[model samples]
Target: MSVKHDWYQSEAKVVITVLLRNAAEKHYAVEISGQRVHMTADDYELDLLLLHPIVPERSSHKAYSTKVEITLAKETGVRWEALEKPAAAAAAAAPPKAQAKNWDKLVSEEEKVEEKEAKGEAALNNLFKKIYSSSSPEVQKAMNKSFSESGGTVLSTNWGEVSKEKVTVKPPEGTEFREWDK
Candidate 1:
């Protein structure tokens, strides 16, 4: 009879479960070397080439009525992709051949992304905010003073120029700056 088996793992250990009808029978023999697991019984045969070396002295197995559980402690705490070498290879398929990228298509994609960004008053405010956030203390001070005193009309980053004069309210063309009622 064909013995069905499945394997799972953690960071430190791997457990292989073998499904057999008469698991309680003591006719099974399990042998473990550095990188191999061999088990045999009356009508069952399980042989596997482990993906990585395991601690032979620390490996063990227990038999129950439903299944036989084999526990193997890994020699190193490395992440295992699969229980067997061939399984690991099959899980990771062969890579595709490298090719040059399409430069024109890539450039058009980048331009389209830029076009999607806000280009109105919000974008201008975001630009000024980014500059102010990354600038030095003096530049931040100048930007704060100019933007507040100019009635949202001007934003200056030059501390030397801004510190020399008082920023006056200069509203946009056709818009007049008026004081709030106090």
Candidate 2:
């Protein structure tokens, strides 16, 4: 005896129930929407329900009891035409102007040059002061020695050494050697 299968049995709007079985013989049920009228025996897999049309002459009694898979129609979310005035207004706000390509480079170069020139002038002034100061010959010799060792005319010594006063010897009170010996 031959059995005849109907295509309308799997048509759209029909809900299909699938049973899932694991290695432990546990069964899980899942439902899927069958919008298409055409379905085939090969279209169904283990726990998967074909919701769309398939080729003709396919059996509908196929068993799918392993894993259930379902496909649903894509949904349209948040239509742009329905947006409120606040969202449109924010998007309409003017954008900031584009920056000049070389502006920052030019500014940084000018600053570096100015800094170098200022340092050079300060160094020259310090060297002039050390060479012409009214300090003692010993201190002057020391400054010149340091300048020569550094290989540059700029005098970078600390102000304390350059401005220190020379120490002078004084006789102790009530202890004059010349008078005490007599």
Q: Which number leads on TM-score?
A: 1
Question: How many pairs of residues collide in each model?
Answer: 0, 4
lDDT of 2 at 119: 62
TM-score of each: 0.47, 0.17
What tens digits encode model 1's per-residue C-alpha lDDT throughout 15-107? 988877576674998898888888777867777777899998999999888888999999999998767776455346332211223557998
RMSD of each: 13.6, 31.0
In angstroms, the error of model 1 at 155 is 38
Clashing pairs in 1: none
Root-mean-square deviation of candidate 2? 31.0
Model 2, 65-170: lDDT tens per residue?
5533233331222222211123344345333211213445888788567556766777666556746585766766656655554444334344456345432223
Scored against the true structure, residue 72 in model 1 reaches a CA lDDT of: 97
